[model samples]
Target: MKAAAYRLTKIKGKGMGLVAARDLKQGSLVVSELPVLFIPGKSNDLLVQEEFAKLHPKKQRQMMELFDVNSTHGGAKTPEGVFITNAYRCPLGNALFPTAARINHSCAPNLTMTHREDTQGRAMIRTACDVREGQELTLCYTDPWLCRQERHEYLERMYDFTCKCSTCSLTGEAMRESERRRERAAVLRVKVAQNLAMCLEHSTPEDLLTEVEEALDIARTELFCEPTIPLMSERAMVLALLCKKPELAQKYADETVRVRLVTEGGHKGLERFRQYAKCPSSHPGAMALGVGSLPAESPDLSAAGRVVPPCYSPMSVVPIEGKGMGVVATRHIIRGELILDEAPLLSLTQLDANLIGGSGASIGSLLLDKLQRISPAQRAAFWQLRETSDSDVGSAARASSIFMCNSTTGADDRMHVYLFGCRFRHNCVPNVLGLDTLSKKNHMRYRAMRDIEEGEEMTVAYVIDDHNFTMGKEELDTLLEQRRVSSCDCELCSLTGPALARSRRRRKKMQALYDESKNYYQPGQLPKLKELISLIEEDIQSPFLVADIHTMALFTALEDEPRSDAAGYHALEALKCKMLSEGDHMGLEQAKAWAERPALARGEKGSTCEYYKPLEFPYVDRDPDMPFAVALRQHEEDVQRQAEEAQQKKAAKKARSKSKKGGQKKKNKGRRH
Candidate 1:
């Protein structure tokens, strides 16, 4: 109805073509119209003739006007031959739109076509990039990723014409280089697909990310714009779900939406990306990959007017009688509950004692230099922490002592100081568990080991080892005194003679059972290991120790019988305990897979176990969202809905055409009477 963006006209060598009547921007709709005839399934001479007869007389004339290269090139002059030259393959079927078919072919096309089944089988054409007023609009009929020689040969064979597009017309070294770039892109595309298919099984997230990046690099260099959209989307998902880097995930998602808008107009796919760009954790895979284990916010200290970010913790700093300051819970906290997840206020690497000039004074000066770069509010927070050094020491020495007292080892063995974390006092037997330093490099995470009542003091072990759990009351007190701490006063440490000795004996025996199980597998040891696990749970209630015992039991079960249900159950128990004790760690993904399918632990051949059943267990209490199975089910549902809608539209269109032809037949019969 409205003026078309392009006009149909004749070209000197290429017969009829569509040329832009006015300047058009990228993603602008060029033409939208229902196909003259829609043929369901594969197009053939018989099917095309049957569908063509159902079209209105005027629409049939329009279809006939479309050029048929096969007829002009000494081939059969049939409706099917014309359909082969013009029909666009879509989810609905092979659609033949008279107006869109006029757009000539080019190896490098400026226009892209999308069939919208929701709009009563409308064919929509949009410019992939800007086009000049007099430029001839074109679309690619063959696969755009094919090399130039392949593209030309296919075009000549199928349509009886050689493509003269700029990309296909390159000469000498330029032509060879273009082919090289395309060939490299093809190789990287295959590698990316293989890696993604085997992700977390044979390939790591890093491997997939690397191959995707290389493919994108080639796509951009070769000016192959279509592949960039999906590649960017994949990179964004991998970063958010696998790598657990929200900032980088958001960055790539935003880029993907922007590129898709220019290449393929707005669609439902872009809406998904927009939501992901706003908050990457909302992605379904984020829950499965434990993305919530990482800190939600990472502040930028480089910005102007930067200040110390407010802590989002459940505890408050309060003074103790002997201890200067300590954090206490304001509300009841559950076991495995994330108590504190905060980025470090300041981070400094531990000086290597083996360095040539490493000294106490040198370390103090280095610490002071790093301190000066932080914001003023952050610096004030750092100094407010308790300093254990003598009053006669210099400022740098006092700062170093405060750091030593408060900071904990992080990734790369660096010292990371947290404002709220440092306020918590230490107990030899602690109620909270800090994730291992090597697990997360950016943020320090602390989760409760056991439930605590409101107003209870939140404590963590400054150092946890065999001595903390296995030592007696007197010996433990002596060790704490040597470390410049007070005597044992907590519930476990306050035990006098008999209770303390029994506790020590149970812990020592538990450790011995764990060691024996790991050294060799024996049928007699299973009951002993299970008994020790129950004893530790009833007496110690230590998640780390429980996880260690379960891990040994899992492997022992496998060594006994690889495909037993006990092996799967123990693997799941071990995974759950590790998640409760350490949040997320290396080999966690593999552990999760093995817990779900124990046969994966054997080899590839074990995947075909007919008796195998996936072990089911609730995830850790930290995240309650749908796991991988539910997410996969949702994806399948969406695909099924699209297919059903396409089929419904096709059937409705066919009924309308049949009803119109029946009315025409009745009118002709009345005229004959």
Candidate 2:
């Protein structure tokens, strides 16, 4: 509504945010506002500078004042860095509603964003996930190339602050792992094209027997690693290039053409592919092998660990008050499961991120209304969930569906871009499970853990901070001092001051270990023997000790002695066994040096540290401090080892006696006894 209570406000660690004036519950619709303004870049070259100049000076000043200028990198104008190097954005786009903007920028964002377009050509901003009234709403800008150093510099410049986001908070091995993923992404693009082609070209009827079998492996690998929307377009291209079947290739090519027209508009870089997208059947690259009529592969949803469950989604034919009309969930859900699957009240490509700001840009929001208007068949599900607001009906009706029912992010996000069922934000330690919906209209289905305590605020984690995803003491401290806002004073951090003090100590100690381990690991090299020890220690002590413990062990081992130590041997053993079991080639190569240790020196199968199953003894509940599980496991191992040693000694003695008797037998035979 236009009321002051629903107004957007500035958040500190979180960035420009929205605060709830009145107490709210899990599924309550908090606020809906028309974007203060939307500056269509097509109309103005210097959209930001000129748009501000046109605004009332007071409002202009307010907008300018909110500029997170430090987002620029060395004054570079990359859209992403310029948006928010710190915790904010360039403040120019039309946001039908942006409660999510208040959250700070993090490479690893918990919240998501989506744009909902309705049948009447209207558009709305939506949360892909839930948010709390007081909690800072965070959304990843989802821009590639925003690596650690660049983000830090951008934040330092524009927001006049440093980022303490989890991505930036990694230390030692964690930092290196992050670097690996980023670098690997940069190099893997060309490899993907070649690899896909290799599969198609290298195979013959004598080799693989069929086209589908030949291309399946390549498709599997490429899809697994960062299959953004652009890649999906690329996949369509690959299909046309590599497939033997003309009809199948043409079908995918049509999608590529459609997506390209909607997103990139055949711009300079994209213009090159224009011919291929359109000329699918006759493209120069179409398989000349005459291999058409091969069997087609079924949609391998589970190939990439993705589940594409069948949809029994019900639709609504009513107007959702703020976000237009939609259906809401009537059932509870678990992570990675379907909550809703509806055809968009509307669907098109201009809604894509690339299309939104570039030429034909207005096309993105121009026809939103054409998509969302519903049909009569859904009148049942439609009427079932539509809600109206009394406070300001006009503004509510005009609000963006994404902001009202979903979250906003980039054009191509699978994890963060929510549909209708994203209004309910959870506490860090939540009691309710948030379900996934695949349409513009969905609902928050809250199921009780026990009996619902009538007024309980059902919530889920805004950021999953459990598993203590930290690297070192400094990193832990940095995050601990971050925006850890919580309403629950009953938890450890809020309840006892001394508990926090002890935690800081543990964190510091753990950090010391990480730093030491990082020094041992070589960039792109197989981790040194020392490095293996470090990762294992961190893995073990993580969550159980201060955040820094594991990394600290690795770091110390790396510097103290890279060659050999019992702990180093064991760490290498334990980690390698895990990696090999999990099929991690990189890990095996890195930990190779320590891998040569005696099998007994390495970890045992039934070790106490293995918490793979529920145990009965040393009851973790009765005495949390005592690691009876470990002690008992080790004791059992020691006993077994001793018994084996005794048997070996006895066998050796008997063998020696037999050999002596054989030597004497020759003398006795010669003598005649």
Candidate 3:
């Protein structure tokens, strides 16, 4: 059964895959193998150059010792071209063995990936999913970040094949819809970033506490649009810590860490998140400490390498040279195996220089240069580890830009990323879930919708809610063009005129409603709150709703139980759920957060003064369409009636006083006469 790793067979152009040569059970072991290659991205570039130059003097000997690297992407019959055409490129100079590289390409896939260290102190891969016999195993051909054309091109140019995957099949309006979703996601990300920057900039510990109490509304709002994206929730927790609410920060941090670990496989990038969960105030990148002082931990990548096993595979969304890149199984992978161990090619510090070129040129080259410009010792050390730029200036810049754009670490300060997994192609719906395991413990796993056969393509979603809401055509065209894709075929690429019109109208209405609800919510009307709820419900069906369901739930609960700790905590779910039907971010921590504060009454009888200050921007008024206005009116009437009653009571007292005074004066005058 252990040798069943040989069960992977060939299907010609379909590439090598796992076949259910027989039936398999749950928790069964699939193919697993130790990786044939190892590449650590650690170096300032000088080091790689120094090492490489060492052999330059012995060209013949060096060529024989090192595997041939083919830069030519074409039809040359030269030995280098054939191998270059065949060599499966991975992180740094690492390449996968032919056993794993022979797999075919697919947009939809069956298996998931996970990696850990075995008793030998070496990283190992094990099955996280069940596989059946005779199923063709395939890997993703493009990174999730690439647009459709980029993916198609990558496969064709490098792998010499064109993709007929589901994502590639979608054309016209459907593609646009997918792009719209991506764009909306990007926009929401910006908004979240903006809010985080603001909080980190102005808010002090006291300010953080109060703002945390309030800004959670926005965090919850953004969660609806992208629940799995942990940045928003992480920021919200950061706010809590700023105000010395360690427990609240710890709670939210736990969630942020969990999501980062599960999806990203616990690389260093997720370590701070893990720490933040355990010790929110102390974790690096804790905004409460001032985003400046709290720094993200970045390690030098030179001379560091993680040995992967054959069973682990990678899924990607990044573009490759020529034919964009995609995910590929690194070995006859078990359900879980070490697909790829990777470190950041370049890490930008929090210093101002990091902002140079806007990540425009090859950051790998730029960074290496910076290291060289430092003191002689530092430059020499950097030079010793660095490798020359293999790409032209534009490509170098693009590569640098790509790295910077996609290089984000979770709350966990450690920088982490899987080389192979980073190559999985993009789709609105992904089958694999990334687990962050590098710095902290990662739980990378893949579940099969059904029995997976050998050589079958395994895929995970790049974006969520692909089935219902997709991107707009303009978005698709714009992004694809920028990424150098000919066009797009995502579900939302093209649409009928009516459908497009409807989509626009829905987006407009949702924005309008969101504004109205935000404004109307100021007085904290309880009964009238149902109006905002209804409006949100109506807007939920729209394709362009920027925030996610979790965000909506958090905001709703905040309104429902203002000044109450119970409700707020219930809605701060930072996890990325695969099942889209989730209504809200409900859980234990949220409940605790809400429970801690207890509820406070808004106003009482004869409470005529407006003691509450209106919230700042992005915390808009409540929906005008809701019953809030009428409820506010009713509350006002009740207050007015109480005022009248108080007035009458005071008038009676005044009259009695005047009468007593008059009687006393008359008696005195009579006595005097």
Task: Give the candidate number with the greatest lDDT.
Answer: 1
Cα deviation of 159, candidate 2, in Å: 3.9
| Candidate 3 to truth, TM | 0.30
Cα lDDT for residue 259, candidate 3: 46
TM-score of each: 0.44, 0.27, 0.30
Cα lDDT tens digits for candidate 2, 563-622: 535334444434423321222224344344333322222334433222232222222222
lDDT of 1 by residue, 491-516 (tens): 77777799977877877887676666
Predictions ranked by TM-score, top down? Answer: 1, 3, 2
Each model's RMSD to truth, in Å?
18.1, 32.1, 33.5
Pairs that collide, model 1:
none
* Most accurate candidate by TM-score: 1
Q: What lDDT does the true structure give each of the candidates? A: 0.66, 0.37, 0.40
Candidate 3, 526: how far from true, in Å?
88
